[model samples]
Target: MMKNIILITLLAGFGFNLNAQPLAPDFTVTDSDGVEHQLYQDYLNQGKTVVIDLFFTYCPPCIALAPTLEDFYESWGGGTGDVEFIGLSIMNDDFNSDCAQFKIDHDVSYPMVGIDGGAIPAVQPYYSGDWGPFEGVPTFVVIHPDGTVDFDPSNGVYDGPGVTGLLEEAIRETGARKPYHLTGTVTMPGGNAIGSFDLNIEGELYSPGQMLPGGLFELDILLRPDSTYEISAVKSGSYNEGLTTFDMIKIRKHVLGIDNFQEPWKYLAADANSSGGISTADLIQLTKLVLAVSDNLPNNDPWGFIKTDYLFASPANPYEEAYQGDARTYMF
Candidate 1:
């Protein structure tokens, strides 16, 4: 009898001191119903406050905390409103059946995830101290929309409606707000749809240039409201893209001082070697690309985008100018 009691106590959770970081680690989990949830992408990035209950099935305190969480979950739109609730099992061996049984036993309506549902790895950062030390099971973590975490929202009170009020108060203290979205279209010259292009925001690679159906892109990721982002696009493939016999002839004429191009961008396009000016060397590279002798332009991308609002100090020689701003750029 004594041995069995000791085993049960060991199976429950061990106590730990609370010393967690303000920022929560992002994770992904699949619930018993097979619904996938990404901590940052799904909930926080969507401007939702998440209340996560980390517990095990056999624990008594965890059992006591379930009904209160259910009431709190329903009060906050039953996982459909600004607040989201997730029940995660800490036991590595607790599968979906164990979590489902726990949910049914307590009449819990929110998502309950177990090892089979990716709960263990999803909560590993908390217990592993990577995000900071955490308390024992039945711990409540309130994560605001901006990825801030309130590790002790319940403050040792987990049995009444007051606990729910505390959670709400913690959320408000974090000053959570909805996120803004950035949307735009990518196209080639003459308004033609680009096959694919890479997207960058604030010098970070956001998209790996996935193929868009009609070059329409929507960034619904974690974009903060009232924030400025330096967005840029890069599309480079097909060495002969926009290069032709006519281009070679034009460069030859410019080199010989026959017919000078008027636009600054035209000079930029003719600098195939990126040599800072138009010359016979550029005509040579353009000729190679047009004849399929080379598949890429040396020292220059096949296309580059410049903001339409850019100004050239030397209009006759636009290579002497440099402007940094928003614009759809491509190089031909």
Candidate 2:
């Protein structure tokens, strides 16, 4: 019983260690003007509070919240150092120029970005709930000035009193006092015209109809820099079913350190080969791998590939005695 308990505890610890979300990744996306924009370096880093809402132009709840979100933006978006509101329009087969026109007809004043292709994963996390099973429209997420997720609503419509109150609370917490420099462009895989599409970023929708051309087919967004973002595109038409492309994006303020750290190996390295942290026990395990005397090397090791491409030069020499001893000494 004690041995089983220890095994279970060790497994639980490993699982938790494996599930950490890496430091946010950054990305660059284009806007309606075909200009490139960086998420984190341009907007979030500029000291402006950001409110990102996701929606489809044709979605009833999204449309209903449009005017309300606009009203909030008018009230809070202007003036120096105030909250910045952005809408990301999830563009799919049903999203087109007509949908954009509908947004214009409704008088939405904020900028909207459109996603092209099937990049749903890019923006799924922003909507809250079980990301893999998101089932709500007009999901909202607020990013604090410091670039951490402040509010993420799972299931519900915006424009409700509760949502408004949450928005207000987010604004109070951000307390940003600087205007954001916004810019970005929309593009297709081959630079082909994205005939009538919507781009959803985070939880906001950017409809082309509200802009100059009846349906601004492509989009690019700019905001405070170093902000995390998700972008996706949807296109719809008669003969073809709707298609979407999703991608998670982060706009970085500076270059990041690149290291080839793979799992299992990294986990083992972290544990110094012992069941836990680096210690004398880990040294014993390292010796086993080195002498090919242990069954620790699984045939289909996920971490093995990662280690080969990153830390070590070859699979045959995955763990050198010197390297193992060094890692165990330092990591512990």
Candidate 3:
């Protein structure tokens, strides 16, 4: 057993990570849904930067990295077909079933599976160095279009700019785009922030981003010159009350990020300004409401968006008119 162990250790030294020279160790793994994915043929072959998340189910940091990785995936020229992402569970035990359950429970939209059933396990020991000191769960490594790997950010791997900064770095490094900067905000009607939610800059406008905590977003992409593009906000979260003094103060607090709000009001809703952001202006609008200087606050909404189901309701339906009797025209 000792001799066998020594031999394996010696063999691993001659493996994939022996100074990053070998072409990105190719592998084929099937997702729990039985969909086959190739590390090179499917991604690097199609001119897309391949990003793989090496993770495990039991790791907390790994779990925390899931959403951020998703956001990064979507923001980096996502819908424009510039990038692809996959998750590989590095669990060295029987975790195929756990991998499937982890995906469902976490609402993971990306492909995920354990390493043992695929070619990935072959290279794991080398890259992971026995899954020791350098084993970073949810380790995000990128494979460039030229069939090169971006394991170390410091090595000029990726350099694209804007949302998903690291990914843009990669895009820039690959010379994939000239890059146009698009920055904006997505807030509730009352000026209350949407917190964090996805925005799809479609018509292939390049990125699909989620709002920053301040309800702001920025996207830099290589769009067709003189061409128009469409942007859509992935309507998420609940619709709560956006009116009342409480709502106005909540908007103020949101803009301020004042967690220690004196009087500690319970918030149901806040964005009164329909500007897709919350700020002092929303507070002013609410002040107008309090003073009766204006009966209508711009947007008349403080919680969330009026989704298409309610926005594009039938005009011929009498109930539709009644439903919108108090609600103003849908805020964009």
Q: Tens digit of lDDT per residue, candidate 1, span 90-112? A: 99778888888888888988988
Error of 1 at 331 (Å): 21
Per-residue alpha-carbon lDDT of model 3 for 290-327, expressed as tens digits? 66676664453222223223322333232333223412
- Alpha carbon deviation, residue 299, candidate 1 (Å): 0.8
Give the candidate number with the greatest lDDT: 1
Stretches of candidate 3 off by over 4 Å are 1-20, 77-80, 119-133, 152-164, 176-332
Better of 1 and 2 by lDDT: 1
- Against the true structure, what is every candidate's RMSD? 16.8, 24.2, 21.3
lDDT score for residue 111 of model 1: 88
lDDT of 1 at 332: 11
- After superposition, the stretches of candidate 2 with alpha carbons farther than 4 Å from their true spots are 1-25, 33-36, 94-99, 117-122, 127-133, 151-157, 177-332
Alpha carbon RMSD to native, model 1: 16.8
**Candidates sorted on lDDT, descending:** 1, 3, 2
The alpha-carbon lDDT assigned to residue 215 of candidate 3 equals 54
- TM-score-superior candidate, 2 or 3: 3
Could you give the candidate ranking by TM-score, starting with the highest?
Answer: 1, 3, 2
Taking all chains together, the TM-score of candidate 3 against the true structure is 0.42
- Give me the overall lDDT of model 2: 0.42
lDDT of 2 by residue, 283-309 (tens): 344344444465352221211111111
